[model samples]
Target: MNRTLIPLAMALILCLLAATAPAADSHPGWFGVIADPGALTIRNGVAGRLSEYTVAIGDPVRPGQIVARIDPEQAAAQLAQMQAQIDAAEAELEGKKATTNSLQERLERILTRPDALSSGALAEMRGNLRTARAETRAAEARLAQQIQERELTRGKIAKTELRSPIQGHVVEYLANVGADLSTDAAVVRLRSAQPLVLRFAFDPRDAAAPSVGTRIRVQEDRSIGAPGNDTRSHTATVESLAMIVDEDSG
Candidate 1:
């Protein structure tokens, strides 16, 4: 009976030591999901049949990179027509300027002529000069209008080419080559190569733990063994913490 009591006493002491020993601290902020801000869903601002697709999924993209082109046949035609109009207007303006210069030269010669008191002829010459000057000014204004119209047409022609707005990876092509697209139709999808953020939902009771500068580890799914293994998953620090409990989840 004494021997049995001694063994039981030893077991009790072992249990006490085990209970007093240091153990891993539990973190309630463990539950988290990755997030990305550079995930882009591209769309066409103009409507037309897709004429070309210059990129594919998983392709790297740069800002202002041309990713696709819509049918530009109509836009190009308008641009050409506007350009021709501008050319014609410019030619007319040059002709008007030349005529105005010639009329001014003739008026100067008439003024310098030795014949004095020719009031009637002088009045007629002055009237013809004013008419030429007015016509020249009108031609100048028309030329300016034509230039503006041509620039507008050029802008429309540029819209047919779709370009990426951000530098990132191409995730998908929503619209295929030769596919018809309406305004605001999605064209391509892209995401940044930068590291993604992890959002964790911490319990309200453990709110004090998730504070700014709190070091944390991000673990990948155990089934995949893709990250947090030999390669090791990315670790991060808490940048911010919510003070108020989420009403929707609560």
Candidate 2:
């Protein structure tokens, strides 16, 4: 009876020690880093030989700043031709107006002198006046069309000068000076002037409990030499959660 009692007492003590042992603390959740940023791709909108490249990789740029230039010789020639056309049209219009005015003046003089003007002569003067007015109208239309063409050419020429779309850093140059570029050809890559994000992934089972903005702890891989070594833990708020599970991981 005594030996059996000793074994029972030993069993009771062991069970009590096992039950009293401290539980492992719950691991703080892990998350992947996500970068929230924008990238810009600069493109040549005009077709021409690239004349100048004013930006280099890693150069900071501002919006509306000119970063490159295409050859403007063609554009300049086009503008000059349009200007000459406009000048010719204007001169022709002026002549037509002058002729129209002279005819009117003669008709007025003849009408004032009733005996001096025959009915047939007056009818002929009226026909001449109508023709002069028609010529003036046609010349004015031509002038207007020339002006519009000149404006369009000027716009296209302006496009040959490439400008930064956003304030950022240049990441690449796709073409160099003297290179022929086609429309929509990429010229440079730019990174947005904004804060960077770190993207990371977490286990789906553990990810379900957290919502966006939920406070959590993050641990980065130690081998990567991320800042704050020895204190590898960071307090990060959840920004988002993935909706679908990755099938390959299953």
Candidate 3:
């Protein structure tokens, strides 16, 4: 009985020592890092001299707002030339179609009175009708192609207007009025107003502390000229946690 009591007393002392041990350090402070870039460059899709520039630096812009315009004179002139060609093709097609109709009528009349016309003359008239029909078809196709080209020119003219792709403040003007810009040339830079995401890196030893859904406090750097020039604090939640430790940082 005395030996059993001694073992029990030693086990109770070991349990008390284990309970008094210090826990792992879990620091909630994380350095500032943006998950998404704050600025985006807006570019034009067409190449031309800028005719109109509407936005300046520090101006607020919304999505689909027209901020710049390229000169549409060249594209518009191309469309006009194509339209004239299409008109001429249509007129020529009309003439060919009228000739085809006349030949068809003559062939029908001759067919009705076969005894009045020689076989050779009827064959020549049929061939002429076929030729007129072919000419008309060719003219129609040419007019269709010209119309398609006109539509493409009009589309190019439409693309001359550069619009903002996001809601943000215009940070810089990459191109000014009368500036020649190539296709995909940047027109303006904008800084988004979306909420910033914070990234925190911690030692792998304390990784168990910042699991998903953990609450954290972030202190903002005070700006010198900002209103009240006060330091701001923001509460952020741990949305995600990286399981793997970064070799260089950890």
Give the CA lDDT, 0 to 100, for residue 145 in model 3. Answer: 87
Write down the lDDT of every candidate, Cα atoms only.
Answer: 0.70, 0.71, 0.72
Q: Supply every candidate's count of residue pairs whose N, Cα or C atoms clash at under 3 angstroms.
A: 1, 8, 0
- Using lDDT as the yardstick, the better of models 1 and 3 is 3
Q: Estimate each model's TM-score.
A: 0.63, 0.67, 0.69
CA lDDT, candidate 2, residue 128 = 92
TM-score (C-alpha, index-matched) for candidate 2: 0.67
Worst 10 residues of 1 by lDDT: 4-13
Model 1: which residue pairs collide?
A: 228-233
- Runs with alpha carbons beyond 4 Å of true place in candidate 2: 1-37, 195-203, 206-238, 242-250
* Model 3 poorest 10 in a row by lDDT: 4-13
Residues 141-247 of candidate 2 have per-residue lDDT tens digits of 99999999999999989999899988888888888779988889998778775543444555444534555665444444565555654524444454554454344
Cα displacement (Å) at residue 190, model 3 = 2.7
| lDDT for each residue of candidate 3 in 116-203, tens digit (9 for 90 to 100) | 7888888888889989999989999998988888888888998998788888888888887898889899887887775457765654
Residue pairs clashing, model 2: 32-200, 32-201, 33-198, 33-199, 33-200, 34-198, 34-199, 35-197
After TM-score superposition, the amount by which residue 133's alpha carbon in candidate 3 deviates from its true location, in angstroms, is 1.0
In terms of lDDT, the poorest run of 10 residues in model 2 is 4-13
C-alpha-based local distance difference test score of model 2: 0.71
Relative to the true structure, candidate 3 reaches a TM of 0.69
